[model samples]
Target chain A: LAKTTQPISMDSYEGQEVNITCSHNNIATNDYITWYQQFPSQGPRFIIQGYKTKVTNEVASLFIPADRKSSTLSLPRVSLSDTAVYYCLVGIMDSSYKLIFGSGTRLLVRP
Target chain B: EPEVTQTPSHQVTQMGQEVILRCVPISNHLYFYWYRQILGQKVEFLVSFYNNEISEKSEIFDDQFSVERPDGSNFTLKIRSTKLEDSAMYFCASSEEDISGELFFGEGSRLTVL
Candidate 1:
């Protein structure tokens, strides 16, 4: 399991793009970067995942540099409802038993 | 989209009492997991189940905790003796494969021990 570091909190305006970066300097070669969003009192929901480079989905995009020491989660045109705690996890895909969630970045999408 | 479902959205129990939290995973999913979050704290992994048995468990999953898949669709977590420290929101989740993809999680079962 790779330990991750992220901002404790961030403020973003509605309709603006938000990017949360996570650092996993000790990330292993088999590790994949995964981001999950959790709303108040709700379980963490998967937002995006990528092994390397960039991967885009309907909800968000993940960008991993070649070094793989860090990754970024980009949310486009954010709304107030997008405010939530975002968790970045690094673990082996299909082999790891459980996801180790660290204190995540809390994004506040303000109007 | 298929989702995981948990029963008794909230539970209140006394110390030393046993409680069982139930979950119904997505119909086609093969992997199940249990996680808990103490109020104002980070989410912690308790255990993961696959092929009708436990694949991994955390240190938090002590002797007091156990997991079972009694039938085809239901996965359950049992706490033999509750403590005040056991109070937290218990979340059940399932994945189509292993960690290769996203996990579908239930709302959660909030357990309060007195």
Candidate 2:
């Protein structure tokens, strides 16, 4: 498992685009970067995932560089409901898919 | 969208008492997992189950903790004897083979040990 680092907190206004970046310098070739959003009292929800380049979904987008050492989660047209803790995980598809979590970035989308 | 569901959204138990958290994962999913989060702390993985057995578990999953897929639809986590430190929010998750690493989590069961 590769360790990840992200901002402790970020503030964004509604209708603005928010980008949260995570760094994993030791990311392996087989490792995939995944982002999860967690709201208060709720479980973590998968937002987006990517190996390299960019991956987009109905909810968010993920961008990875050539080095694969870092990734960013972009949320477009944020709303207050989007305020949550965003976790960045790096993992491989091993026999067991256990996700290691860190002190994710707490994104606050203000109205 | 199919989602994971957990029972007894909140549970309160006395120290040394046995407690069970129940979960019903997505119908088509094959893998199940349990995670816990202490107040104001990061979420921690506890165990993963597949093929009617535990595939992996973390150090936090001590001898007192156990998981069982008793039926076709229900997966359960049982703590033999609860302790104060065991009080936390326990989340149940599932993922399919096609999207192995993409997990769908439940709302979580908040356990309080007194």
Candidate 3:
């Protein structure tokens, strides 16, 4: 499993866009980048995943540069309710048995 | 939007007692997993189950820990004898058979061991 690093915490005002980046310099060839959001006392929900380049969903967008060593999760017009801890994981999709989670980025969307 | 579901949102147990956590994964999901998070700590994987047996397990899953898919719809984790140190939030997750590793997590079960 590749290790990931992200900001410990961040603050954003309501209605503003937020971008959180993750670095995984040793990401493996079969690794797929995935992001998850977890509200207090709730489960971590899958936000987006990508192999390379970019991937977008109804909730968020993921941008990966050619290096594939890093990626960013972009949330548009975030609201106070969007405040949550965000986790970035890199592993083989549908192929790996192990998934390691780091301390995650605590995003505070202040109103 | 089928989601994974876990029962007993909260559990308070005494040390040396047995406890079982239950989960009902998405109907179509084929791989199941268990993870635990102590207060203010990172999430840790305990075990993964596939094809009627364990696919992988972390060191944290010890001899006292066991997992079973007793029925088609229910997955369970049983701790033979709980310890105070076992206090933590336990989460269950599942994914499609293809192994894309995009696991969908259930709202954890908070286990409070005293």
Best by DockQ: 3
Ranking by TM-score: 1, 3, 2
For the candidates in turn, chain A alone yields TM-scores of: 0.88, 0.88, 0.88
- All candidates: TM-score: 0.92, 0.91, 0.91
Model 3, B1-114: lDDT tens digits are: 899999899999999999999999999889999999888776778999998899888879999999999999999999999999999999999999434659999999999999
**Which residue pairs collide, candidate 2?**
none
Q: Candidate 1, residues B1-114: lDDT per residue as tens digits?
A: 778999889999999999999999999999999999998877877998999899888879999999999999899999999999999999999988665646778999999999
* DockQ, candidate 3, vs. native dimer: 0.58
* Model 2 regions lying over 4 Å from their true place: A25-28, A92-97
Error of 3 at B114 (Å): 0.1
- Where is model 1 chain A poorest over a 10-residue stretch in terms of lDDT? A90-99
Q: Quote the RMSD, in angstroms, for model 2.
A: 2.4
Output the worst ten-in-a-row residue range by lDDT, candidate 2 chain A. A91-100
- In order, the candidates keep a fraction of the true contacts of 0.52, 0.60, 0.67
Q: What DockQ does each listed candidate score?
A: 0.56, 0.57, 0.58
TM-score of chain A of 2: 0.88
lDDT of each: 0.87, 0.87, 0.87
In model 3, the runs with Cα more than 4 Å from the true position are A92-97
